[model samples]
Target: MEPVVLAAGTALVAAMASDAWEAARGALVDLWRKGKPEEAEAVGNELQRARTVALESRRTVDPDAEQALIGFWRMRLDHLLRERPDLARELRGVLEDDLVPTLGAGERDRATTLLGRAEAHDHARIYQAGRDQHIHGG
Candidate 1:
């Protein structure tokens, strides 16, 4: 779950480097509004600020600054998820349909696809991840 949020956050910020980021921004703001209706305008304003920093960091060739922006967005998304878990699937939709598609050819390489499934029956428990995973007392 954390990994999925991280991937989506990273992809959304990466989309900021694209000229088509407005569409992505709109999609995200719409999602935020759907989940927390009162925060729609605020989220749009915040995303705009993030976009500004992302573009500036790119122009200065400052990867660290862009990384900081990704971290910030990731935290924000995490909170949003905590507040409204139902939006999780819609968040993924925005990532795939809006954010990733906004990336340019060069930036597209930074995007990753993750698939995870956990199944359990009776006394069993399952933990799944797209990459690394750990099991205790299995």
Candidate 2:
């Protein structure tokens, strides 16, 4: 379980570098450029907190650490979703189709269920378009 946790955390951190941090920085920069330095700083601080938590978490094997890591990822995802819903949808699909399938059985089931709930919540107010497509023609 420790190995599995390490592997998952590492993979997730790598993805975070490419997705979460990059997007957060871009948004922060945009905020800064638009005369919202406080907002930009707040976002940067949150991102730093997330990374600090992850780095410290990698040194231990506590079950509570897993939830902290998960919370970091969830917050990152939520930030991205709010800033760019279309990209968030694409990223969610990528996670569901690729990353989730590579996890252990229990983790995979949990991830799948979570993704379903996320999708439903994201589209809660919108009407469906068809059987295969989401309400937004997604």
Candidate 3:
């Protein structure tokens, strides 16, 4: 391979790896907020390793597919990340402006259900965390 091509490939791989790490961290934080700290940490570690492998194979990996998968995970995180009312409102705005128009009746129903669950879980997790912190004085 040409040196210039190899350098570009390395740069692309680094970007991919960074994106993957961010996605994995978001996922782990989501899980931690949902009351599964151990599982979240495990998955986060695994994802970090996956990102390393993907970066090492950047020449062959499809960046588009990786992006699509990242989008999926990000959507999951957005739905579940309701700890901040401001963030939730912002996400809802995006959903209304972007996702709502694209969704049909069945899809809307599913989306609503999923959002409800995520919000409920987020609320509960926050409450528990606060309670724990109060009790522990930390």
Q: Which numbered prediction scores highest in TM-score against the true structure?
A: 1
| Per-residue alpha-carbon lDDT of candidate 1 for residues 30-67, written as tens digits (9 for 90 to 100) | 99889998999999999999989998998999999988
Cα-based lDDT for every prediction: 0.83, 0.47, 0.43
lDDT of 3 by residue, 1-138 (tens): 222222222222233344334642453445445544546666565556656656655557676755544444454444445343344543444344434334455544534443332245543543433123454555
Model 3 RMSD vs true structure: 18.3
Which model is ahead, 1 or 3, in terms of lDDT? Answer: 1
| TM-scores for every predicted model | 0.79, 0.43, 0.32
User: Model 2, residue 36: what's the lDDT?
Assistant: 42
lDDT of 2 by residue, 1-138 (tens): 122233333334433323344553344344333444456667566656655665566466454765666655555455544665555444544454445544556555555443333145653664443237634355
Give candidate 2 misplaced runs (Cα > 4 Å): 1-60, 117-138
Ten contiguous residues minimizing lDDT sum, candidate 2: 1-10
Off by over 4 Å in 3: 1-38, 82-138
Cα RMSD (angstroms) for every candidate in the order listed: 4.9, 11.3, 18.3
Quality of model 1 by C-alpha lDDT: 0.83
